[model samples]
Target: MKNGPLFFFGLFAALTLSWAGTVLLSHHQLGGLAPFYDENESAAFPLRQPGVAARGQLVYADLGCASCHTQQVRRPEFGADQAHGWGERQSVARDYIFQARPQLGALRVGPDLANLGGRKPAYDSDDLISLLYTGVIPGAKAVTHPYYKFLFDERPVVGEKSAVALKLTGALAASAGSQIVPTERAQSLVAFLLSLNNSYDYPEARPFVEKTEKKEGEKK
Candidate 1:
């Protein structure tokens, strides 16, 4: 109790140092990072998100998708992200330099989306829209994700049906003379989800596997 002032000052100092070490230091390190240029592809890594995709990221945050999904992939040895196709390598600071606010979710209630756009057998825009509207994947018997039905509008078709209208069949279909179409938010959200690609093999992302040279000529 006698050293109360000193104790409080020490606590404040510790907190200040922690903040500087984590946040400020990180900003100083990554703030000026530029995209990695690839000679073979003649393009830079981590392409900037398109205008629509950027807006979609806002929608994604608004919907709290990060609560269920993660945007960072751990090292393969640390996790099974590579085996499961979540990502091919661990995410590096460079991977997120272009994101407005990186959604490095804390929990993995659903799968990580750090590389969703680069996933094999990629999910097309229509596929994503259908999944969002139905809460079910194309062939899955169970619902995989929440159906943001509010993002869609069910209305009568005026002319030749909307080009963006949902091509639903079975009981999920809209009533005759009507078509289901994605609203602006739905389009934006889908665009954002489709933009989640981190396939670029940045130097920092690759794990360092030390090579062990076999003895000079151990019986070939």
Candidate 2:
């Protein structure tokens, strides 16, 4: 019985090493295949001011948020993901070529963020930010999302809603509450999210590409 167990373990180890060697050897070939067969496109609008989004990526990683959320969308065969509109297609390698370390998260506690940039209502970044800070969607039942009030400053409102602010300011002001309000940080994060639109299917991105190509041709 002891010999049987040892033999199986050894066999497993050998097979694992052989598989690793084969994959490593094939890695270059796989990369070369991307630009040829991979027609995946880049995001549409500018979200983060390049530096900020790069920093926000650090935020995503530092928070360990990736543990609970997967950035990639699985195709139809792997699951019923299509019905949810999480993404239109399975994530391909080209989608992440620019990431210094891509965030193909390991689990799915939260919905996939693959196409979240333009997916939300009216494509509103503020609403998403507010949701992140409150986690209580006003009249809706309490949600399981985390509150991120620790990351923002409490500033006075600028527009016509100051009256409601005075009422809530007594209780919900940054000083009185433990929440971060998430306005700017959420905006930054949403900027990052809104940037996730790969134009492979989105009509919104097409015009921008044409305009840019025209400009470049004129320059040439």
Count clashes in each candidate, considering only residues at least 3 apart in sequence or on different chains: 0, 3
Superposed model 1: Cα runs more than 4 Å off:
3-8, 211-220
lDDT (Cα, tens digit) per residue for candidate 1, span 1-220: 4799999999999999999999999889888999999887899988999999899999989899899888888898997888989887888888887889888998898888888888997989999899999999767978878898999999999989999999988999999999999999999888888888887777667677565564643321
Once model 1 is optimally superposed onto the true structure by TM-score, how far is the C-alpha of residue 181 displaced, in angstroms? 0.4
TM-score of each: 0.89, 0.62
- Which prediction has the highest TM-score against the true structure? 1
In model 2, the clashing pairs are: 117-194, 149-179, 149-180
lDDT value, residue 21 of candidate 2 = 86
RMSD of 1: 4.5
In angstroms, give how far residue 189 of model 1 lies from its true place: 1.1
- Assess candidate 1 and give its lDDT: 0.87
TM-score of 1: 0.89
**lDDT for each candidate structure:** 0.87, 0.58
